[model samples]
Target: MSAAETTTAKVPPTRPSTAQGAGGGTGGAGKPAVRRRAGGGAALPWTLLAPCLLVLLLVLGYPLARLVALSFQKFGQPQLWGFQEPESVGFANFTKILGDGEFWAVVVRTIVFAGGAVILTMVLGMLTALLLQRVSGWVKTLINIALVASWGMPIIVATAIFKWLFDTDYGVLNWLLSRLPGVDMVGHNWFASGPQGLAVIMLLVVWGAVPFVVITLSAGLTQVPKELEEAARLDGAGSWGVFRYVTLPVLKPIIVMLTTLSVIWDMGVFPQVFVMRNGHPEAEFQLLTTYSYDKAFVVNDYGGGSAIALVTVVLLLGVVAVYMRQMLKIGEVE
Candidate 1:
């Protein structure tokens, strides 16, 4: 061969671009790297999530399992202390609770209380959030500070404050009300009637609940497009109309989330009622949580209490599932 032919022969042949392989094309050299990267990307999430999943399994999983098991068995002091083996009562406990009129009453009361509290919280929260938007910068800052302060207050402390405020004779509320013309409110026992007392507790719940809702809504409100609101205004939309058409659609998801959360929190209200009533809620004031406690610890009917608690969990789960469905529908609509 000539010198030029020899030089050409010595040069290596050009290979296909590895970009094709990286993009899952014909180039084989980059395929492994792509697979490796994709595999790592998929695995990273699970690896990061492993600790949380394990913690939940350890913390919540075992207790939940135990609760279910206890609900199915005739577990009481005897069984708890190992003096007698827990008898398998199957669905008897559930049957008893379901048949009991008192249980049904408590369930109804819980639902009503929760519904009312959630409604009040969401309204007050949304109003507060809107107010925050309209306020000056310093006023907004002060409002945010107040919201955070209230939100950070311990539930027990708040409950105690509420209890004192509603106290019969020496309460600040009665004192203030007595100051009004023709109002003889010197001594008013807020806890005399169940409805009256629950109303107070509901106020307390709403008070505590509103701060978080307000903060969440405030954050969500920031995401609302100013241009949209301006456009709405230019189109002859009144304040209510603008809010209903432009603001509400942007805020629907946040409102839904807050409402759902408020429902869960209000439904599970225990400390406020329990503490306000001095750990002994009256028959009329009894919620599902208190009732379950009464049956298990007070009445020593562990199986029945477990069943009640399980039923409550089921009810809450059902409510949450409904919320989830609504959220899914919202997602589809959006």
Candidate 2:
């Protein structure tokens, strides 16, 4: 029973420590270490996200605040903060814009244009997505490349191309129409009238927007489980039946998202119309966005422009509110 013999006897048998055993021990020595390790690991992720948060605040927050402030002021005045400053006109500008007949016309035109563009883009995009899903190899690659190429092109450049294509005289479209059977005087002035101008604008907007919808829908399509689709087919479902019952329900959320985003994008469309017709012959083809620009810059009426911008913001907010309500209802069902 000497000290050495006692120590050797006590060390004779023992169990190795485990995670649970270590944590459960009386002194709780391992718990703090475990927590520290977890906290240290979390820091990396937050560090990685820090830059993005900083950029978002710097790039988006500042400009948005300035825009809101600008909408409340008169033109040619120094802004109380950064950039321009204008006199406070209260709601006078808003009232003036609301009273203007042309403002309502532009608003209606914008809504119709955006609505039509979203519908057409969604339809075309969905069809293209389904078709592409069924194909593979080189053909799929080619299609993807073409779509991405169009999407990657600059908006101004694309509008310029469309402008040339639809030009009234000495344009390729007019030239092609001249050769068609039973068609004489084929060189129609595409932007000479409101209807024609709006149609051209719609084409441009849809063309730019369709690729985005296609990319988003195609990604969502990839997430859809193939077995469910196969099961529907095995149950004597035709293509339409399969799509209506199986695909549509599954894709509804994404479709709604794409549609909402498309509407927002088309509503703010300015460059195409501005570049194409300079707000058109008599500004008949002017949209809310272009109208705002004209009011502020063209006519040097900053107050009216601010009022127009404020109204546009309200309209957009209303659209967003409606979408949010619809989304909540959809969520409730699930």
**RMSD per prediction, one decimal?**
4.1, 5.3
Off by over 4 Å in 2: 1-50, 77-85, 278-281, 325-334
Candidate 1 lDDT over 115-144, as tens digits, reads: 999999998999988988888999999888
Work out the TM-score per prediction.
0.91, 0.81
C-alpha displacement of 277 in model 1, angstroms? 0.5
The candidate scoring highest on TM-score is 1
lDDT of each: 0.91, 0.83
User: Candidate 1: deviation at residue 156, Å?
Assistant: 1.6
Poorest stretch of ten by lDDT in candidate 2: 76-85
Q: Of the candidates shown, which would achieve the greatest lDDT relative to the real structure?
A: 1
Kindly report the root-mean-square deviation of model 1 from the true structure over all alpha carbons.
Answer: 4.1
